[model samples]
Target: MNINGLEKTKTFSFDRSHSAKVLFKRPDKFREIEDLSKHNRTLINTGSNLSYSPLGFYKDSISVKLKKFNRIIDFNLKKKEITVESGITLSQLLNFTLLYDLWIPQLPGYPFITIGGAIASDAHGKSCALHGTIKNSIKEMTIFHIKNGWLSLSEKENKEIYNLTIGGIGLTGTIVNVTLKLEEFKNKNFITYKTKVNSVNECISEITKKSKEKDSFVYSWNMAENLKSLGKGFVFQNKINDDNVENFKFIPEEKKNKFLPFLPIWNKLTLKTANWIFYYLNNSSNHFQEDDFTSVIFPFYGKEAYFKFFGKKGFYESQLLISENTIEDFFDEFKFIYKKFNPTISLFSVKNMRGTQEFLRFEGNKICVTFDFINNKKNILFMSELDKICVKLKIIPSIIKDSRLSKKIVEQCYPEYSRFRDLINNYDKKRIYKSEISQRLEI
Candidate 1:
């Protein structure tokens, strides 16, 4: 089953942040994964390797890429359910399910990420405030281990493993495939309203109010270009509708972000220009415009060039999930830091999240802020200070986003951190499944 595999001396992670010398494996079937685990060093099962964090591989360890496992196992239209290989990407699943007038309800901004990645990260989607994460749609998971061989995990079967596997950061085992209880979807168009706000508080207010609605997705872009207009940005309120409206004829094919190493485009000048242009463009747009599901779900599909803007040095994305009570202090402190650092943020957005927090999943009635900045001393220092502030506010920094997050910060942020560590340690005594994230966080 291990038809093809090659060792690589180094690999830059999908996030373009961390790179490491790794032992690599491309296994076609479950048996190969088991066999490799028996012989290799600590291993991590990799999907598309699209995660911002180095969730797929560790330095000098076995990284098993699971592309061949991509396949559709079964579909039940009557129940609006599907079973698919964990290696399958969200784009692949969406393309297939859309034809049948069905779709997965919860989908992250980037659709190139694999089903396994979504389940592993418990990633929140556009409907994050509504459904929480992909876990709510997942009915069952089939995982393989050196000792367990194959285990079907669900609420009714292998419940403990089921709980741990969701947002376990792939430290549990190799996720073979999954059965998702999907949704019947037909509203392909959304009436989107982009409103310009004068302050971060107003933008956050818009997102919070719109989040409670069933047929819409809401998010805010916080501008960090100026001290006076630091938190002033636009809030997008997209409301799904069955009404006929103009949209892109087809979803754009996912493509690799062409690296612009020689000519970086994310410096202070470009950041300011881009912000000025983007702010006006969206701000000047019609009060209401129709967009397709593709536009709403995969915001980065055709705009992957945004990533290329980071150049060879890459970028850092830090997101924290904190309660509304913390946002006032968080916003004030963040603005103060922005004024002090004056780092050019390539992208900054905030959204509303509501769900139960467990394990390491990012959830809760929280306002989540994401800041993407080019990798540099100033930006790194800014993020480092931000991390300290997060710890001070007891805000939960996204464990899967920030590559440099320390175990101490994680221990402080997540009250159940010890429980997660102990559970997985007891489950996998040898730690057969591992990644840079797991090792870095001392999981």
Candidate 2:
């Protein structure tokens, strides 16, 4: 309930809030679908605040916690599908899938996010250009609606509701569970390559070319100081291949027995300075290998303690997706804004995005630019400026990471906004399922 450097009422008289302490609130049953139909107050759906973007902002609504629903109902190996309760987190599912050599095709920056949370925002990641958004990996979903009871939706049946739920931001109804498509890997090793580039345009060209090869993952770092490596930080290009003794690095018995604490470090000034230093280093060539595909697929596979990274200030991130054709123009705009604001941005990352047919898919021949900033007044002001720029250019900003963007801008970013609004109205005429964002955006 507390955020950094700011003191505001956590609960207002017209608003409601609920917090579920872990372990104590684990329930063993599901209520009748109709029970979720109508609530007397507005609701805010939350899983984890891993979203530095806009995942958890609601007004005049009671907070709804889904952790009690975490469960794996069924899975079909032949069909490559798994049905899971909505509250299950990504880390849990990742661990579960390892037993079957299966993995979710799309993963976002953080692993603690819930399955329903990811679907709500249509989450994506570095390999999106090759695979697709999280929506593409969903086989189907079940939502508890006020008027419709429990409805199972897919692209084939109840397509509107399906599309609405995926990237729908949980406005249509409360998502109770999901059936996602799983992918099996060859258990091959991935050869990672780190490369440096000179500018954003050149980085885009490299990723576009590399992604055509079918097996590639690139993560680019944007330089905010040195002009030489201004757009180049590091690139991890991976390829599947046979793993031999020489191709692998072994962990000795002695090393395996030792335990060392991971020092928590990464602050606003430190991160910005690090980026500046890496820009000057201008050299990138690093490689590592995992013996099997499972370990590699869940790259950042661990519980996230992000507070350690940003310390007390926490961190905020804004992600924007623009058409491939606008790559140069977008960078040009960024360069101008970077010089004008000179805000303390800890890091900048870029990834290539492939198109998706989901109604709310943040896709196209787009390139995703994500910026991480410390939570502070100056940083928030800079984000407001960036939001204004994105709106002016008509670029669709990713709402998952940005916490400061106004709802009006959010409405402008998605073309299917009105349709989603209509769907929400059909189920919650009294606006029982409302959030600060929904009201501001008029959804």
Candidate 3:
């Protein structure tokens, strides 16, 4: 259906967890965005249609997609910077940047996430300990609001809005264009060193030590379903080298995933079998890859079926960014919750993350652990218990990962939650721009 030459579509979150019919517009020109800003009180942007959580699509609300806004405005070789429109995908950006042996330091695992969406979500990568979130690469941006019009923001210019807009979840305004600070791609290679860990504590300890190595990524694939060896897993430390490696071709985006099941396919026994096979398969201690750039980016590009297996019931991802001091205590409660609920945890992983702990941003110097649970009453209730732990331990649960996260938990977790809300209210009093995240969190 078409309304006002704009498409009307039933938009579902990437995880199929939330759905809403929206008046969708793919506007290219800054004028169109500004004009929409003037008229629509309820507006938000959608990108790649790929966020796990709903990105502000209420009934009849206008959703602007920046597909046509993709363009490379400027590329300075010496400065290692590129100015691009918000619609440009990270894959596209890297294709262009890698031609000149330059790329964005903060690379998202998904290939098709737009520059705008990355900024809005403040997406973090596996190597956040080294480079932090996408906010670190953003040198400047031009955002449009009804009142502010087209305002250029940066650290030194409009610093407050810049900070807010980074993880603001698109409430601040429509981010039209962004100037990303790029890094020169030297001959850097990483060797994946896998070690068998006894428990979650061992994993965290190894990750902490591994993170100290410069330009390294650390993560653990835990067998959380096993009570006897809970959190027993392999710690993968990708340590870097300056040696040159043969370039591999970029993995193009796969066609629409056809395996979206009608019923959920993940269960404890099934997951346990799969996790066990994967765990011991890498008996070797080290993996040598040919090219860092090609292999490191877009880990999810070819693995769409993993998401589809959740089917209509969808899934819930609770990614907690908890401080080092509180993690030990938090895990005590975590184990109790796991034992009590015995929730169907399909997948579990942990990453060593280090970034700013600021208003509404999930990034922090903490142990970032994520769990994928089948969407059911038991799992849902289990997640609620985790939320309680988050509040008690001052952990920041990722708002972008879960659609059902409560505003009260958000308020309790983030110290500057009220401040972020107040800033948005003051910046755009009518709050013309809002997303699913903002409305849910009452931001």
Candidate number of the best lDDT: 1
How large an RMSD does model 3 have?
2.0
lDDT per residue (tens digit) for residues 91-129 in model 2: 678667656767776887555678878888888766788
Q: Model 3 over residues 200-264: C-alpha lDDT tens digits?
A: 88988988888888767877888888566778888887665556565635546444455555556
Which regions of candidate 1 fall more than 4 Å away from where they truly are? 1-4, 245-262
Of candidates 2 and 1, the better by TM-score: 1
Give a tens-digit lDDT track for model 1, residues 343-415: 8787778888878888888887788889888899988888888988888998998988888888998998888
> What overall lDDT, based on C-alpha atoms, would model 3 receive against the true structure?
0.81
Q: Which stretches of candidate 3 lie over 4 Å from their true place?
A: 37-41, 240-244, 251-263, 284-292
The per-model lDDT (C-alpha) reads 0.82, 0.64, 0.81
TM-score for each candidate, following the candidate numbering = 0.95, 0.81, 0.95
Indicate whether candidate 2 or candidate 3 has the larger lDDT. 3
Relative to the unseen true structure, what is the C-alpha lDDT of residue 171 in candidate 3, on a scale of 0 to 100?
84
- After aligning candidate 2 to the native by TM-score, how far in Å is the CA of 356 from where it should be? 3.4
Better of 1 and 2 by lDDT: 1
